[model samples]
Target chain A: MTRRLPDPRPQVEIVAGRAHVVGQQCAACGLRTTLVVSACPGCRGELAPVRFGPDGTVWGSTVIRVPVAGRTPPYCLAYVDLDGGPRVLVHVKASTEPVAVGTRVRLRGDSGGDLVVELVR
Target chain B: MSHQAAVLGVGTSSFGKQPEVPLAQLAWSAVQEALSDSGVDARGIEAAYVGSVLGPFGSAQRALQGLGIGRIPVITVENACASGTTAFHEACWAVREGRYETVLVLGQEHMSSRITGAIPPDLGDPEGRSGLALPGVYAMAASRYMARYGLTLRQLAQVSVKNHGHALGNSRAQYSGDYTVEEVLASPLIADPLTLLQCCPISDGAAALVVGRAAARRDAVRVRSCALRSGRAWGYRSEHAWGFEIVRETAEAAYAEAGLGASEADLFEVHDSFTIGEILSIEGLGLAAEGEGGRLTESGHTALGGPQPVNPSGGLLSRGHPLGCTGVAQLAEVTWQLRGQAGARQVEGARIGVVETMGGGVAGLDGNACVVAVLERP
Candidate 1:
């Protein structure tokens, strides 16, 4: 007699998205919200599609001491609220230290254009 | 609104790096102990939630199915280290929602694989992809904290020493060896300001609890109020990265829910993912004032036998951070104490306990999935 083994995989599928431009439009008023993506996070509206600009400005920043993926410790993580409609999480390759919030930045997409991000101003 | 929830039973598997046991069996050890303690069998369970940060592939369903508890719906929560408490919050909420009479909250994980260098999913996120591994992440924060607050590495080492002393008596702890503050500082820097001894070893452990709406008996422990909230951005609030100042906001809400102030809580088990965590958490939890946690630890005010005993089970630092099992493990210690069952590590006259679990990556979860529960002696 032969026996079968269960699939060695998880039931959940978690994906990693790269930096890329994604649209965020409003429904009720039929007007575009802020250049940033979140109209209302707690209770979101029926968001529509509107292409964003490739550039952005750094609104805030933080340096994590715990484990991360791409860069090493003392690396920079920033909150870049873009020109079009979404605020993206990104890294400033140039310097991990001494970068202030509100630095002008250009929204740059990763190689695949899936995860949209911004570099230093 | 103070809700009356009691911990009827508490169970925990031996905590360490155990690849020998399957994930399900790890959970099973706690389940069996809890069921027997609560005097409630699997049949009495209306719902179940499992908290696991790393379950080695489909461990939740696999583990639940073996115990006959799979018949009840199982929802697994993964909030990094807070995963287990996140499960606890959900189980308690189910009872609060009146959807389930008896709920089982289990936090279990096996991270022995880290012996070969394991990178968690957060590192896979693009943010982490830029490096910033656990040590790097917290160390970076600690470095900045030192610059701003004039903190020292010795104070951080003392945090580890105090907990190690506490763990010497906790059989369920991941680490129990006693180390001096000097030994902690000499343990080699995994990250600046954080030495090997300063950081918690990745562990494999399981802790389980059986909670119900009934009143706790003399031998049972009651949960006066349970509260869990996610991190939210107040827009330029900057509290997310700053310790305690932000977490304090949530602690206040939990105390208010219990109709008691911070002065009433006797014991605390917080998410001490890093040594700095304990410093900030104590203050954030209102056990100390802002920027005063370091002073409290130096003065031995937060030791196991101190004024407000913190992390008597050695906490995540000495107990081994099995991620999912930590929060429930904290609950296990509290339940044991309130019921007068903590053996050598018990806190005398302990009542109105607090188990604060801050999960997920970052100094504090920046408004992502977060939860906290406050339990009282009722």
Candidate 2:
């Protein structure tokens, strides 16, 4: 018989036909982070699974014009600060123009298992 | 039996794309020069510490072949880009603790043979798996910095122009040109707000240093202090950029140990892996206040002839970055400057110099590691 190991941290999930990023919230400190961790980095408290955003603010972003590790050129990568406390690095859906920092974005779906976000407007 | 350590000799292979040179050959060139410079033969070295990020396993042993150093301990260290300086730091500690009277430190990398484009991020990392490369990471920081401090595109391009101009005098530098801000901006864009010139070129090179007890040489450059620290977990509430706090913390430790302030140093060889990196590094080293690095660069205070000349050897931007070799190369440049041997790029009457190298990137942390060292003429 073969046994499969469980993965506690799931970066993305579809809820009610909308994709949302998953994070952990510390029970003691109430700190939330998208980074996978067993214990709270802030207070070493027990953590519970939590879902964040279909909506967030772009903390920072860049247009990668060079190819890297099989990824094509001219794709935008951004750090999105979700409506909740967690922040995540995700790929922004390529648009006619580059995404601006502080622009509101919403999670569209998953692209190759990586979260994909789009401009809210 | 404890003694203070000093850098008795330094050497480096010319920095550039040299796919023709093998890793061992590249490393041996630097090792031979360093040994000869110190007036010490291969047999005189008591132990060796080699730093290489991407070289084959047992690279140190391979590089030391036919050196006739016997069966002495040949330890290897890999701390990402800071590997070279970390090796130097370890060699100094061994000498200072009296475990070895003299030790050899070498940092080598042959990127052309191994990497073609941008250095790939660790796929194991969540961010790296999300299609984030090194340039993308720095571009994000540049974006945030611009949003917060109103930094202009011209100010960022000036760093590339300044370093490339400084490289004109460095015979061993990989790239050198009298580039205007407009020219720098016009270079192909690798990432938004950062052009190809702003990013360091991948090259092959090696640097070596001989570390011994300070009393061993009458004209030795004393190793005032070497501080190394790993990044701490940074929350969203943090005010500074990702790697800023670690550099600051490490520099503070180095300053306290050296018994000198940032103002006392006449020159600095900082890790300018990217144009934005130079600004972030200077601020982290206390050379400028937070968010003031752009203004400081624009004011030309960190230029070759300014009050505090930085990267007179051209830095990683113009000098070429060969992963593990960069830190050792920076130290070698500092050693040369202190000895007044740095030809045309020399800072007149230079006495004190600082070398800082920060390395690695991981999720949830400011940086992987940082090494800061203070050197002074004795």
True contacts kept of each: 0.06, 0.56
Off by over 4 Å in 1: A1-121, B1-3, B113-115, B121-124, B234-246, B362-367
Specify the highest-lDDT model's number: 2
Query: Chain B in candidate 1 has what TM-score?
Result: 0.93
* CA deviation > 4 Å runs, candidate 2: A1-10
B58-126, model 1: which lDDT tens digit per residue? Answer: 788787778887677888888776788778877777776677778898888888854444354342243
- Return the TM-score for candidate 2, rounded to 2 decimals: 0.96
Instruction: Report lDDT (CA) for all predictions.
Output: 0.68, 0.87
Q: Clashes in candidate 2: how many?
A: 0
* lDDT, candidate 2, at B150: 83
lDDT of 1 by residue, A1-121 (tens): 1114332111111224323354445576443322233564323567766555456766545554444333345645555556643455555555545345557776455432123344542
Per-residue lDDT value at B12 in model 2: 92
